[model samples]
Target chain A: MLSEEDRRKGAELLLQAERERKPIPQLSKTFPDIEIEDAYRIQDYWAQARIAAGARVAGHKIGLTSRAMQLASKMTEPDYGRILDDAFYNDGARIPASRFIKPRLEVELAFIMGEDLAGPGVRIYDVLRATEFVVPALEVIDYRTEVPRAITDTIADNAAFGSIVVGGRPVRPFDVDLRWVGATLSQNGIIEETGVSAGIMGHPAAGIAWLVNKLHVVGTGLEKGQIVLAGSFTRPVDITAGDIIQVDYGPLGAIGVSFI
Target chain B: MALDWKTLEAFAEHLENAELERRAITKITDDCPDLSWEEAYAIQDCIRARKVARGVRITGLKMGLTSLAKMTQMGVEDPIHGFITDYGMVPDGGEIAMDALIHPKVEAEVGFVLKRPLSGPGVDIDMVLAATDRIVPAVEVIDSRYRDFRFDLKSVIADNTSAARYVVGSSTTPFAASDLHRLNVVLEKNGSVVAEGVGATVLGHPAASVAMLANMLGRKGEGWEVPAEALILTGGITEAVPVARGDWIDVRYKDFGSVSLHFV
Candidate 1:
């Protein structure tokens, strides 16, 4: 177990590094004495600090859920972190890139809850019963760590959820075969990325089931009215300060954003 | 605070202690400029210790910047990952205040649940199916904590990728009947078609993404033993769009139903 002293010290160190724009060494080198569990302790402290600073906990983001992502990050497992209220955005609007250090965009599906979802024996049917609707969303991913972070380093940081865009077309959970849903991502009127909803774990909501089960193991559950980015279909698009990014979803409609 | 094996059995002990001391002193002391990486880890070590005390269980992890475009934008070749916690889940159709997040963003994605255990190093689509469970619809809300949400890959990873809000719709489909590669997804703003996409775009299929995840972790000797019930997110289907206040974004999965969100 991490002691209060250690938690505070770790947060201070990270805060200091961030303040001075310094880098933290990998746990393997800096503290051969540290363990995965210990690294999470620092993450907890970081979350606490955010909470203490008035950040309201929102939802959780799953990262490195794919093999390609793990290989790129040089890590082997998925990571997660908290979402706060101050970071949320809406549809048909301008998101000033100035609010982000280095912001990137991704197209994804969004889910609305109809009932309560708890962990520990939560079934797919339960998720369906609890869900009220589904829609297209754009996830803005921003990071807080250094460039080219090791898996362990990333774990210490949250999953890098910069902001989110939701509320487009509302599809009934049972009305359509999610696997058949498709999307095309364009930048400056040019297609850059494309894919279908099935790319996100067969059916998009399946990712949420994974998230719920994962959280249940930690004694958590999914509440109503929260937004979960089921996962991405295409590789993320490169977003520039003045780029007009658009994600087209055939029948469900389309969403666009301009970085300024 | 001696650093020895026996004394450091709980390594968190020394780290946490030192951190508290530093925290107390730093408030009064002049901010130390140019702290070393070793020093940063020292503090990280301490925070990890305290988390254990809080009983915050370690859930799964996530990778960021996996997309070629994201990597190029960040000026880095590799992606970054972070951890998810039990306290992060939110409900669909619920009200969310925007004041708590740093710079939040949202996206649409398909979620997968496993029916059996699957590991990496040699896992494939067949493996994903053999171990498949029910599938559902979902949406992810991302929010960064950095000032103006600015940071490099490493810094973002440390900040947990700004993960924030999320909602899963009440819809389930059998994996066998699910045609992931051909699936069509649409994002609507104010009831208008704004974005569209398909499933094949996510590394071929979302299940393939899972196979990759298993294999990646296998190399670390900690690959997922994916039980009969494990949820996995398969990356984004389209590019992320910007949002503002009082907007309603809906994501419709052609055959899987739809989910929506209202930002106030």
Candidate 2:
């Protein structure tokens, strides 16, 4: 357990790094005693500070739900973050390249909920029942901390969510087999990666179900009309200025973003 | 025929999702040919409820098609109202993404910030000006979720009058010191003038639009009123100008300076 002072200091470090657009040393290196609970405390402090500064919480995001991601990160658990409204961009938006430390893109699906969901036993069916629709989205990941981060360090940094670009046609969860939904991500007209939604914990909604049950332990739940970016299905793709990213979701439509 | 609450909510979710995802769909009227104005408003109310439930703050209300010219252009005789949320506001000189809209157009108008609550079936321009704290130049970016921006009155109303984003100018002109009816507005795109009109183009006077909105809301019996400190956008004074990526829109108000935006 981290002391209250240490938790605040951890939050301040991450916040300062974000504001300055500079990466700092991992929190795990400085706070060797840091636990998952302490990491969440630090994230909560930083999120509250951002809200105080006039940013609204638009949604929540789940990360590292895939076995591949877990293996790559050397972590066995998923992490979550508060998605702020300022971090949302329209499709084909030219995002400023200077706003991130080391920005990368991940292809994912976003669930827009129609009803509030809470639970210790929330299941895939519950997520489907509560979901209004699923739309294609691009998660902009930025690291505010140095490389070689631990799970505790990543959670404290808001799961590395910099922003999200939402576009494409929305479909009801039952309208299509979400597990088979596939995406082809291209950069500058070159295909970089392709994957199916099943890579997200078997089914995309499964991650949302997991998040709801997890949040129940903290006395919070997913609100009605909130957007949830389920875990990314593909590996992170490096982005650079003047790069145009297009992710085709086949019949679900497509989403694009330009970094400038 | 009366529509059930559940059906109205379903339609609201459908339309709201289109707006949020920046995708276009066929107008609702095409599917429900006999939809009534009351039912349209009900669906709009459902949209407002969903947004509020999602933690979106209601910043104000907006009136669309208040001008006789706009009514004639759209072949509609009455105006429509829609709620504006915090997400709908864009900073001056901000960049609007083209991908977030199906087909977007810009309109020059005046925005009213009220100092007192105004509700009525008998509210007039005098009462509107008396309640107003400041009036600022504004440019509204209207993006219809309907395919090709073609929709009937009922369809457009339920779609929130095609409201997407708006920017309020920094300069606030007092109502008493300015002559709104005679004020000319020039809308320029990329340094070239596109459309120009006087404030009188908006229902004789811009304040008349707000007065009409209050009367309309009061008659609906929804308990909805223009609250104090609410920002009300009067209907467009000029015809809508189409915009695209890399376009810079500048609306110059006669006395209230100007508001500009970029589409990127």
Candidate 3:
């Protein structure tokens, strides 16, 4: 556990890293006893600060939901992060490379909820019923901390969420089988990764259900009109300036973004 | 505001040519910025006339974006309708020529063969079921005539909701024989399951999509009714799965048999 003072300091460090687009040393290194709860507290402090500064929380993002992702990250469970309004982009957006440090991209499906969802036992059926549509999206992940970072450090850094680019055809949740939704990611016209949404813990909505239940533990829930990015299915692909990233979601359509 | 018949015809021809050539053009709305919904439907009617003049028979109609998910994804608030031509038919377990489509994607649907003509300003689910003679498994191949499949409602309506080709299953069942809302559908590509959905995926009940279609047509004007013996594809039950040449697509409809097609 971290002292409240230590948590505040960690929040400041993350904020500074984001503001300067520079990576900072891991928080776990400084506070060896920092617990997952402490890390969440630090994240909450940072999120509150941002919200107070006029950045609204648009929705939540669940990360590390897939077993493959969990194994790759050496984490046992998924983590949640806030998606701020300023970090959202549309398809074909040209984003400045300098906005993030050591960014990577992952293809995902975003759910736009039509009704508020809170849960102690929110199931996939509830998510399906509440979802207005599902659209293809690309998550820009930026590790604000230096390497050798622990899970606590990552959790405090808002699960490495930087921004998101959503595009492609939206389909009603029931219109298509969400589990079989496939995404093919390409950079500079070369295919880099391919995967199906079922990788997100058997089904993409399963992750949303997990998130809702997790949030309900803290008396919060997914709100209507919010965009929730279910965890990514494909492995993260490194990105750089001048890179053109496109994700083809088959019948769901396609979305592309360029970094400059 | 209303558009002149000449302008609507020109737009219709532009879209018809794109469809015939299997080429994509920019959305029609880019040229006709102020095109209204009525004008868009007029243009669509004009396209249908041209096809009929060329000996193509209108076999049925289809609903697109009928589900809330589809509407949200397309950024549209309402569902759209389009015509299905006899030339668009691909037999079950048959092949679809890849060269005849721009970029095609297949979606599983429930096909309704009507026995009684149905029109609506107030059509409901019961009325739709009463008029439907049989419900069969179906797969619709949608290929937008707009470059990149990007278009607004007006543009998509003018392009016939990207309707390309479709295959209906051989077996037919009474609409009341099964629970339409709970029927499961699994779509496979190359022997692997690529998509799965339920009959409820099409606006709660597939019949609801047909009802909405009838109502939309009634609202359009007089003398517009889904004719008897017409086959109506109750929109896509699952998201359209992309296909390529040599790919085999199969859709399994629970209790209703299956539909298969190959892209050649």
Candidate 4:
């Protein structure tokens, strides 16, 4: 575990890197003794600084829910990150590519909760019942630090979050089978990736159930009216300036954005 | 012809769900064309009972569709009533999240804070003024759960007169019927005055709506009456104007001061 000073330095480095639109060396290299708890503390410190500076905690994002990734990392639990309102954008938004450093996009489902969800034994049914609706979304994940990054580095960097763009048809949690919902990611008129909602830990809301339980250990819980992004179903597609990204969820509708 | 108790419960459930989910659904009247006004009020009561059971405090009641223009436009003779909740209270000059509402519109209104509990079968404007406390400027944010804001009187009544949120001004004035007479009403959006009218447009006197509300309640099942110390919103004075994200709304009541809101 790193010392308090070390965690503060790590958080400052990540925040400065993001502010300057620059990527720093992985924190794991800077603090070889960094622990997962330290990473989260550093992330917390980073979030506190931002919130103190006027950024709001809009919601949360869950990542590393894929079985293959979990097996590769030998982790049994999914990781979480706080979503800042500063990074929120609506569908068909014209985003300036200059705002991010080497940004990439992921296809995911976003659950907007209607009620507070607490942990310890929160079930999938509870998540569904609490969720107001599900909508198609695009998560732009950008690295604030260099690659060859360890879990500590990623966690401290807010799960590599950049921003999120949400649009398309919103359906009630029980309006249709969530697992069967599918979408295709298109970039510059080419279909790059396609995925089913089930790819997110067998069901998109299952990760939220995990998130709520995990938060309970820390005396925290998912707040009412907060958005929760289920982990990506498709691989992150590289994005650059002047790229047009469109994600089609078939009958549910499509979300389109411009990178300029 | 009254519907079964189970049907009322189901309608209440759907209406509440649409509100909580912030999604619009077809009007209930579309499915049941013969749905009576009394049945609509029953469904509304069921919705109110559900809210009360959940511990959501009913702060005040609102009178809607009372303006002569609104009544003529909707072809209605009487104003409809609905209750507001504590969760729906927006502070003066506060921001409202657009995502929390389906499609919101703002109405310039006056809120009557009662000094004493008054009930009536023959409540008149003089009686309403006699029991009054102070009057405050208010902007009622009406958001209908019906798709495209298309709903009959009966449908809207069951949907709580499309009440989503409300803002009460920090300033207040003592009750006087003459003070409300011919007062200039203005609604500004994004720094531009878009709507204007006279305060008397709300059925000659704003207090008249409260009397109407009290009388209507007196005619309801078992004669329901409004309790004392309640803050009641009179019907809209000017036309209700549509609002959206990034829109700054400022409603000025000639002498009652102004209530402003920023949408985000």
Candidate 5:
């Protein structure tokens, strides 16, 4: 366990690292007694502070859901973090490169809720019943932790969510079989990647089920009209200034964007 | 969906120079505030415009909150999504530039090629199985943008899920009546086994993760599209260990061939 003072100092150290772009010695160096859970508490404390500072919580991001990612991070389970309103994007939009520290882009699915969802036992059907619409989206994830973060560091960094883009048409939750949805991702007129929706837990909605059920224990719930990013089907990619990104969802229409 | 560039610039500058204490960031968020969700989205659109203006390709999509434990740890109650660009995708057995990234992590995953189109509402796991044309092994490289890698959710989303590089390994036998959960996965750093795991770590099985993704998209009125080959990375099977330049990483699935990556 970490003392409250250690938690505060840890938060302070994180802020300093962000502001100065300087590295802080590992938490192990400072407290020598810090546990992964303690690190998370400090991170949560800092997150609450950001929220209190008016960072309107938008949704959450899950990481290490894949067995492979878990091994890399040296963790057995998955991790998550929050998203704010400022992180969202729409289709056929332009993103400025100057605004981000080291921005990158990812294609994903975004879920828009139609009704409130709380859990402990929120089944996949419940998620479907409450969902109003769904859109093909892109998630831009960024982090605010020391470089070379461990799983604990990533969890503390809120799963590194940065921005999101939703494009093409909105499909009804009951319109099609989402698990097998297909996509061919092209960049600058070339095929760079391809994927199916089922790659994400057989169906992306199961992530939401996991989210609600997990959050229920924390005394939280997903509200209506909130957009949730299920996770990535393809591996993530890097972006530089002046890059055009387009995703074709076939029947769902298409989404395009560029970075300047 | 445009940012007050000037304000954003000022905030960035403030973030750079401010003390980075809880008090300092709190003061800045209070004083500078963040853009509305709509406004932030506009910024994303603007980025797309910029990309078009330049000539980068738009690649596949990524899921943000796929892990149950992560959601519980972050104090956030829901999951989010993001975008990927063609410029970001790296080929299998390829090298990634170290200078181009602030920090990068790798995740092994399962890739699915679609035989047909799929959409949502009642998309089921069986449907996914029926639609899967092929299954392959893959690796995702994640990096973030915020200085010192610090950001709230919104700022990070605007940055796009810290996407960096990825490599798809060789495909293997399909899950057709097989146990994806029990399959063994060994992660090797420079030809040595650094980590070992199984598919069950990713919410029990990668298929289950895909199932969740389908249902989530269905709620959004969007079903996973047809002919959409997906690399459903079922999150990390083990912890996200760090790597440096000149490091060679390979993920060997018991059923799937090895997927490899190198850093330079």
Candidate 6:
């Protein structure tokens, strides 16, 4: 049970880590009593400080949405964090290497909300109805906290969200067969990962449905006009400043970006 | 003459009804030129309460006419503040139904969210910078409810400062990541650059508007310290651009991402 001050300090350390482009010791290591709830509050504090400084929540990102990721993280469900406006990018944008300590790229789909979505009994269909469109996205996963991370630590680190680059074709939720959408992630012209949308809890929207239901417990819900990253389908690929990344979403479209 | 509680409630209802009906009405100040800012704010508060009563959530806050050029243009010494509601947000990359709005215009803005509560008698830029969490690029789609968008400042305040649809960038950068005053924004309409301005145009720095808002809100109460996590739109960086049906508007802020909207 981390105290309020402890949580605030945790956020401050992360902010310092962000500013210095360095990693800090895991919060779980420094504050062993920190619970999942505490981790979220710490993340909240980190985000709110940014908001106070003037960042806006453009959307949310859910992590560990797959069984493999959950198993790897030793968690049963996914974790999430707000996707601040600065963390968003256009396809083909060149990202500087100095922006992160260590960054990995993951292939995912992004859901753009068309209507408000809330919980208690939210489901995939509800998500489908609420989603205006889905586009191919690449999540630049980085950590401000040091790894070998605990679930609490990952949660507090905003699910290791570094930045998100979205491109390719966008389609309405019902316009395509989402379950079978496919992609191949290439780094420097070499195929490093391939994935199917079904790999995300059998449906990409399912995790978003789960997310809204979770947010409901906290007296919040997914607002309209927000973007949601539905979680990675392919395994994360290591990235460096000079690396070029391409994710081909088949008929949906493709995204190309480079780190410099 | 002082407004009675019943009259203020009626005023809120009347303006809100105009909004709901997608109709424009005359500004109240045209009739009652002596409307106090307090009463104007009270009426604005009443409108928000009415919205809450209808299950609409207050999303954030907005400041209007913060730029010296705009203040001088409007003949005002201080900027105005208003509330934003959830229903007023436009989806990123989404199109607006043109008929749903009345003479909408676009204002490219710098939006802020704070890490800590800010209240003030003496809040300054450094204080604002210290408290801010991150900076997000936003475009406010304002549709004034007054006929022909003409109204005195007090009357406009009562109309919630033309609070309407808004779109924010899906990314944010820490305050230290960029120089605020030097930041530049270009407003593009259908691929044409229509306007441009620097961040300093917003009262020398957007943070100054935030500081003024905090100080203004503080003076009203013990301090309605703009709370942490409150998303505040600092104000227009460029002149608000007019839009019509089938028009697309996009604003790009230096070092920040772009937010675009289309009218359909």
By DockQ, the best candidate is 1
Cα error, residue B132 of model 5, in Å, equals: 22
Clashes in model 4: which pairs?
B117-B228
| Residues forming the 10-long window of minimal summed lDDT in candidate 4 chain A | A190-199
Query: Which TM-score does chain B of candidate 3 obtain?
Result: 0.95
* DockQ scores for all predicted structures: 0.14, 0.01, 0.04, 0.01, 0.02, 0.01
Question: How do the predictions measure up, each by TM-score?
Answer: 0.49, 0.50, 0.56, 0.50, 0.49, 0.50
**What local lDDT score does residue A194 receive in model 5, on the 0 to 100 scale?**
49
Off by over 4 Å in 1: A1-7, A12-35, A71-77, B1-264
lDDT of 1 by residue, B1-264 (tens): 223434223333433332233221111001223333233333333444455568864443444454545555657643444444454455565545555443456777676778676777898877886676766566666665444544545334434444456666665444342477556677666664445566655555666666666675565466335444545656666555456677787887765777788777
Candidate 3 has an lDDT of 0.85
lDDT of 4 by residue, A198-246 (tens): 6577678999999999889889998888999998877688899889998
True-contact fraction in model 5 equals 0.00
lDDT of 6 by residue, A12-128 (tens): 999999999999999999999999999999999999999999999999999997676787888988999889999988999999978988899998999999999999999999999
lDDT scores in order: 0.62, 0.85, 0.85, 0.84, 0.65, 0.85
Colliding residue pairs in candidate 2:
none
| lDDT tens readout by residue for model 2, A1-260 | 89999999999999999999999999999899999999999999999999999999988999997765677688766889989999999998999978999999999999999999999999999999999999999999999999988989889999999999999999999998887566767677645555567667767898899899989999999999899999887678888899999887767898988999
Model 3 alpha-carbon miss at residue A225, Å: 37
Residues A1-260, model 1: lDDT tens digits = 45557655665665555445455544334444455566666767877887898888776666655434655776655566666777777766788876664577877887777776877766666777788888888888765555665555565655656788875688888877665667777787645688666556556766678778877776777788776777776667657688888777767888888888
What TM-score does prediction 3 earn?
Answer: 0.56
Query: Model 5, residue A249: displacement in angstroms?
Result: 1.9
Which stretches of candidate 2 lie above 4 Å from their native place?
A: B1-264
* Cα TM-score of candidate 5: 0.49
Model 5 CA deviation exceeding 4 Å by range: A15-36, B1-264
lDDT of model 4 at position B223: 48
Chain A vs. native, model 4, TM-score: 0.98
Mark the 10 consecutive residues where model 2 chain A has the least summed lDDT: A190-199
